[model samples]
Target: MLLDALLFQLGYNAALVMIGAGLLGLAAGMAGTFLFLRKRALVSDAISHATLPGIAVAFIVMEAFGGDGRSLAGLLIGAICASALGLAAVTYLGNRTRLSEDAAIGAVLSVFFGFGIVLLTVIQAFGYGRQSGLEGFLLGSTAGMLRSDATLIAVSAALTCAIVLLMRRPLTVAAFDPGFARVSGQRPDWAEAVLMAVVLAVTVVGLKVVGLILIVALLIIPPVAARFWSDQSTHVLWISSIIGGLAGYFGAALSAIAPDLPTGPIIVLCAFGLFLVSFLFAPERGVLASVLRHFRFRRDVHMRQGLLALAQGHPIFEDLTLKLLIRAGFASADGVPTDTGRARAAKALRDEARWREVRGDPAFERAAARYDGLTDLSDVLTEDQLREVDARIGPPVGAA
Candidate 1:
């Protein structure tokens, strides 16, 4: 049953919805990479909330024109127009006023979304026949998605992907270093405009699947989760796209299985789950990995300090430290420095001496003068060379 559902063997309607949702995920993930890198992640949120007014206006305008207010194309056109206006407002506020980009985003998001709520209430009061299902666009409902809607989503997603692929290099350059790109004769502003257009397109197309409220999650989460897995831009893009597609596929499938559930929140929750997993377990970067690396570093430093103390003929204070050093072949069972132990101790001493010199310690300067014209202890000294300095210095000051 699981395999069949996964492979889309569970009826044509379910398959269509799943495919559309997956494609939407793929496109959002790809475009979101540039958005994430440019630090415009919240811009997507503003744009999405901004679309709500567009959708409401589109429905009202269609009803006035004696057409069905729920016509998908008219609704989408309204969404696009309203979103563009919102984008312009945000840009204007950011450029012309003292508002920062985030402030502008927050302003537009709240104001436009508030206006949309008012408009929705007005529409509800007007008693339009098609207005009943209009609220579905708020939280999204895939149960109402027809084959045509799925096809439209698929085409839009494909177009968005194609644009990203064709302009990948320029987009990457602009995203990473716009000033350098402009100096190098590339039109960074133009590339950025094109990228924003792609974002708008994806946002518009995704309205039916995830709605305006949760759509930003689709744009932001996958790329963030993918970041935990790779540092390279190309790899991040691929991983993000895969994560997004999987989230869409599984979220839609699960929602379909449980007919009472809404699809948009499910999809966002699935993406968030993937993000949590990445945060906890990704190699080298995850929480567990970072903690392990910290402990390992402390252990190595502790063992190195023990070796240094032994070289200075100081008493070993910890019996476990002595046992560990002997087991590692750095000391004899009698707690005395073997040849390997002496060599390791000399290296540790040189490292400490170099660090002290870098830190401008007067003691290290005086010690250096005793080593026959050595002005800087920048390089590691031989065992004999280090021993001569150590003898002159008379064992680091605190050694017991």
Candidate 2:
């Protein structure tokens, strides 16, 4: 029964809506990679909030003109206009005033959202027809999504994806280093404009499925989560898109089954869940991985230190440390250095002496400071040069 409900029992409307939401997620995730790289994640929040007043105003204008006040086209047109204006305001404020991009984003988000609330109030008091559904734009309501709405979302998402793919190279260059891109004769401003357009399109389409408040999460979380898994921007982009699409698909499916839950928050929660998982378990970067790496590094350092002490006839501090060295073949059962252990200890002491000398140089102070508490000196000093230094100075006093 459960399997049938999941695979075969879904009605046509539910399937279409789910597909549309998934596509919207895919586009948002793709475009969001650039936005995340550029550190413009909050721009989507500003644009989405700014669209609220535009939606209300569009409905008012349509009613005044004797047309359907709830026309999707008219509402989307208003949303675009308002979102553009908000973008312009953010750019202007950031460039012309002392306000930074974050400050400008906050200012625009609050003012525009407040104005939208006022407009919504006016519509409720004096508008001719039902304005009840208009509030859905704030929190999102996918229940009323029609086949036409789904088709429109799919088309918009496809176009956005195509544009991103075509502009990938220049966009990536600009995203990482605008100055270098300009030096290479690429117009970063043009690339930024194109990116903003893509963000606007995604934001506008997402309003119905995820709503204005939560749509920014759709844009920001997937890329951030993907970043935990890879350092390459190309890998991040694909992973982010997959995570976003899955979030949308599964969230919509669950909502369809429940029939009482809101789709927007569920989608956001799914993305958040993925982010949390990545934060904890991603190889090399996740919290658990980082902790394990630190533990291994500390253990290695202690073992190397104990080997040096044993070579110099110094006291070995811990029984466990000695056992670890023996287990690793650096020492014998009697806690004496083996042939390999003596050579390793000599090299370790020599490298440490070289590292100390290099770190003391004024020229290397800054660079050496970056490796505080590091056990291996081989990374900074080559074996050939360290051997030369060892020949000249010999190992430290007791490290023979």
User: Which structure among the candidates has the greatest TM-score?
Assistant: 2
The parts of candidate 1 lying over 4 Å away from their true place are 315-400
Model 1 whole-model lDDT (C-alpha atoms):
0.83
Displacement of the residue 246 alpha carbon in candidate 2, Å: 1.1
Tens digit of lDDT per residue, candidate 1, span 27-146? 899899889988899898899899998899888888898988877778889999999989989999998999999999999999999999999999999887655577888877888677
**Per-model CA lDDT versus the true structure:** 0.83, 0.85
Clash numbers, per candidate: 0, 0
What is the alpha-carbon lDDT of model 2 when measured against the actual structure? Answer: 0.85
What TM-score would every model get versus the actual structure?
Answer: 0.84, 0.84
Deviation in Å, model 2, residue 146 alpha carbon: 0.7
Instruction: Tell me the lDDT of model 2 at 103.
Output: 94
Candidate 1, residue 98: CA error in Å? 1.4
